[model samples]
Target: MSVNENLAFDALSDRVRRQILSILGEGGELTVTEIAESVDMVGRSTVSSHLRILRTSGVVNERRDGRRRYYSLDTEGSVRDAFLFLQTILRGGVHFDVEATKSADVAGEIQQDVS
Candidate 1:
């Protein structure tokens, strides 16, 4: 994988970051406060840190609305590239057994759904 792809995957390696991405993927944009609420046990500063990493990785877009910043998935950037890269790998004769991975948590379950 390329460096950009590697960075994207690295950003996604953290469970908290993945949860943030899941919130963004669900629908409309959310402010930092709103995002903090959705994630368990994470404080504002921590969420901000995750958002910073995600923004730096190009997986998310940030919009300034007055005093607040709203974050959402970046449709045309690293997130797209990451998904495309995974698709390419899966299409190259790789096969997965979904039932075998079902007992894992939501993070692992996502791959089963994709498969």
Candidate 2:
């Protein structure tokens, strides 16, 4: 598969990663332990490993607060850029750009439309 397809599938493969994104949406930031606890699916180490993938992929941002690490989703702008990488393999050759990312200034635009 292409890089874009890889990213979306990678993001979707583990249930933990999807939940992590949800938690980040709520807390805006969470430590490794906190995330593990919130999901109750696996250990902190497991969550950390997933976080590593997300961090490396530029889907999530991390910051260290002393011994604790906090993570959150990249803003719409950032995620849009990442999602655009998958556009090439969207079952069509159509291209997507930053301007296409914007719909309304209203919050929950993505979540609302998707559901």
Best by lDDT: 1
Model 2 clashing residue pairs (backbone): none
Over the stretch 65-112, how does candidate 2's per-residue lDDT look in tens digits? 887788888764344565666654573533243334443433467678
Clashing pairs in 1: none
| C-alpha lDDT score of every prediction, in listed order | 0.87, 0.72
Estimate, for each residue in 34-74, the C-alpha lDDT of model 1 and write its tens digit: 99988996998999999999999998999998999999988
Q: List candidate 1 stretches off by more than 4 Å.
A: 93-115
Error of 2 at 21 (Å): 0.8
Whose TM-score is greatest here? Answer: 1
Clashes per candidate (backbone, < 3 Å): 0, 0
Q: How far in Å is the alpha carbon of 41 misplaced in model 1?
A: 2.8
Judged by whole-model lDDT over C-alpha atoms, candidate 1 comes out at: 0.87
